[model samples]
Target: MPSAIRFSGVSRHYGNVKAVDGVDMDIAEGEFFAMLGPSGSGKTTSLRLIAGFEQPTAGDIHIFGHVAQGLPPYKRNVNTVFQDYALFPHLNVRDNVAYGLMVAGQAKAERYRSAERALDMVALGGYGDRKPSALSGGQRQRVALARALVNEPKALLLDEPLGALDLKLREQMQEELKSLQRSLGITFIFVTHDQGEALSMADRVAVFNEGRIVQTGTPEDIYYRPEVPFVADFVGSSNVLPPEIMRDIRGVDAYGALRPEAVRRCDAGHDAWVRNVSFLGASTRVSMQVHGVAMTMLLPRGAEIPAVGSTIQVCWQQDDLHVMSR
Candidate 1:
């Protein structure tokens, strides 16, 4: 399939700082693509560039087959839903969702009908007359989504659209957004710092840091086979074993990564003791010290919780290990 959005050697710099440096990526048409990273990691800047909110300092950005660098946001054939909603306080939900069409000289009756349909698509039916202040954070976000959807853009650029909601609401919205994307069959470029959101919702994710895309892959590939130390540490909180230990375990001089779930509490292997135990609803997170290195293990809820300070043996299969370069 053709790309919905492509960045060819794109960079956005401000004086000595590079907000987005040399990012080259393709977001396939109708795919749920995520740009994930921590603060100042350039994920948001990349999203802005796609939405035409920010221009590249170098190289080019393409929407579909057209160059979008010089085109203004309204002409880019894409719409953006921001974290803050950006709704007009004076306008009701219907008017807010129809604003884009109205600005484009769409007839009042037609825009209202389209806006209502969009609101229904977002499960905000009958909410047209409600003011932004009357709605909850999640509702406001849905209205924002409805507004973006009403535009019927080829792709949607979402910049932390769920960042403002509570944990439960955020999780709920995640599923809703995924469903919405599937139903619409339009490309979605979602920008978020939340690892859970990216892993759970995106068909493919681009991990960014220091203005560069460090890795891009499916959620499982990125989590299970990180190419770099940063990706291993960031994606799944995987334990990065020391080179000496890795050499001993795998007989190779390289950085090693082991997922918490891959760790097993064995009767004999390496002398270790449980240091901490965290009760996570479905699983227990056990922190242990093995050969002086801290390792985490996620045990099923029904499994015995290792007593803190009690010595135990921890082992993992060689196949479960991911050896990466420095």
Candidate 2:
């Protein structure tokens, strides 16, 4: 499939600081692609460049085969749903959604029709006349989305769209957004700092660091076979162990990573004493000291919780170990 958005050797700078450094990415048509990273990782900057909010200091951006370097946000075939929602206070939900169409010189009837359809697509039907201040956070976000979708852009860029919402609302919106994307069949370029959000929603995720993309893959690939130590540690909980190579194993590096779920409590194995136990609702997490290194393991709920300072065995299959270079 042709790329919906492409960044080729892209770099952006603020004086000497490299806000986005040499990013090369292709977001496939109709795919839910997420840029996941911490603050200052250039994820948002990359999204802005695609949205034509910022020009690249070097290289090029292409949206649907057109060079997007000089195009303004409105000229490009895209819309952005920002973290703040950015609704017009004076405008009701319908007017806010119809604003884009109206600006494009759409007829009043056509604009309202498009806005109403967009609102219904977001499950906010019959909410057109309500003011932004009168709606809840989630409703306001839906209004912003309806506004963006009412234009029927080729792609949608979301810059931390759910960052302002509470945890429960965030999760709810995540599912809603994913479902909306599938139903609309439009390419979505989502930016977020939350790993869980990306893992749960994106079809594939690009992990960013220090203004560069460190890794890009499916959530399973990012979690189970992270090529770099940063990807392993950043995407999920992992216990990085010191380099210990066994001669019999092929393609095995000296350094190893074990996910908490991969490590199991056994009656016999390498000796370890439990240092702490955290009883999560679904599972019990136990931290242990083995060979002077701390390791964590997850036991299923209802399993005998190990007491702190009690000797236990920690065992894992060689296949379960992820070997990566630092």
Candidate 3:
């Protein structure tokens, strides 16, 4: 498949500060891609650069084989959904959704028809006449989404689109957004700092840090086989074991990474004292200390919860060990 978005040595700067520094990446057409990182990590800057909201200080950006350097956001074959929703308070849901079409001078009747369909796509049917303030946070978010999708852009750039909603609503919208993306089959370049959102929704994810992409891979790959220490620590709450401890476990002198799921209770293995057990609804998080090294484990619900200060044998398979630095 051809590239939907491509960046070649792209850099954006303000004075001496580099927001996006020499980043190169490609998002295949119809792929659901995510840019993930902490605050000031440059993921949002990269998204804005793609949307033509921010120009590159150096290098070039391409959208569907066309150079996107000088094109205005309207000229590009994409639309953006910001964290704030950016919906017009004065307009009803219908007009807010049709705003883009109206700007393009689309026929009023036709735009309204498309707006209704778009609203229905976001499960907001019959919500046409409601004012922005009348809707809940989730509903207003759908309105913002409907507005963006109504334009039928080739790709969608989302900058923390789910940031404003409560947890349950955010998760619901995540699934909805994923389903919508699959149905539309358009490239979705989503920017988010949430690991669960990125892992659960994206076909592939690019990990950003300090204005650079440290690693890019499928969700499983990013989670199970992080190549860098930052990625291992950031994507999920991983235990980065010291080289000596890793060598003792794996017979190799290298930094080791293990997910919470990797460490498990066993009948025969190294002994550790359970420090704390946190009940997290569907799972129990176990914090233990082994040979003076603190480690965390995630056990599924219904498992016997070890009491605090109790000693237990824990073991992990060789396959679960990921050597991050050698």
Candidate 4:
């Protein structure tokens, strides 16, 4: 399938700082692709480049097979939902959503119809007349989304769209946005610092660091078989042991990463002494000293929580170990 958005060797700079460096990506048509990273990792910069808000200092950008490099923001078939929603406070929900169409010189009836359909699509039906100040944060966000979707853009560019919402509302909107993308079948390029959000929503995620993409894969691929130590440690919590490769079987470094869950608590047989036990609601996180190195293990709920300073055997199968060079 032809990609809806593509970036080839894209880079952007602010004076001496390379905000986005050598990013190459292909966002498939109708795919929910997320760029995940920490602050200053260039995810937002990449999104801005795609939206034509910023021009790449090197390389090129293409949207639906057309070179999008020199095109202005409005000329590109993309709409952005920013962190603040960027709604017009003076306009009602309907008017805010209809503004884009109206600016494009669409007829009043056609603009209203498009706005109404978009509002309905976002479950904000009949909210056209409500002012932004009268709406909740989630509702305002919906209005922003409706405004973006009403244009029927080729792709939606989201830069931390849910960052302002509280945790519960953020999760709720995450689900709503994912469902909306699937229903609409439009490409989505989302930028976020939240690993959980990207893991939950993205069809495939590109992990960025210091202006470059470190890894790109499905959530499971990134979580279970991270190609680099940064990808493994950043994506989820894991016991990153600095063990020498004692063996290599089937291309896996046999003596490397051991997920906390993979190490089971056995009778005092293995060489480990428990140092601490943290209650994590559904499971207990056990920190232990193994061969003079600190390690952790996760025991399932209802399992006996080991006492601090107790001797316990921590055993893991070879397959559970993910070996990556430091």
What digit string (tens of lDDT, one per residue) describes model 2 on residues 151-257?
88999999999999999999999999999999889999999999999999999999999999999999988888787767877886777666553222334545567
Candidate 2 vs candidate 4: which has greater TM-score? 2
Can you tell me which runs of candidate 1 are displaced by over 4 Å? none
Off by over 4 Å in 4: 243-255, 268-270
Error of 1 at 315 (Å): 0.6
The residue-by-residue lDDT of candidate 4 on 1-326, one tens digit each, is: 88898899999999999999999999899999999999999999999998888999999888999999999998988999988999998888889999999999999999999999999988899999989999998888888899998998989999899998999999999999999999889999999999999999999999999999999999998888777767777886666665443342235443366677888966554578889989999898988997677788889999888889878777777678787654
Ranked by TM-score, the better of candidates 2 and 3 is 2
- Candidate 1 has an lDDT of 0.92
Greater-TM-score candidate between 1 and 3: 1
Per-candidate Cα RMSD to the true structure, in Å, reads 1.4, 2.1, 2.0, 2.3
Please, what is the whole-model Cα lDDT of each candidate in the order they appear? 0.92, 0.88, 0.92, 0.87
TM-score of each: 0.96, 0.94, 0.92, 0.93
Q: What is the lDDT of residue 262 in candidate 3?
A: 84
Locate the minimum summed-lDDT window of 10 residues in model 1.
264-273
lDDT of 2 at 69: 97
How displaced is residue 309 in candidate 4, in Å?
2.9
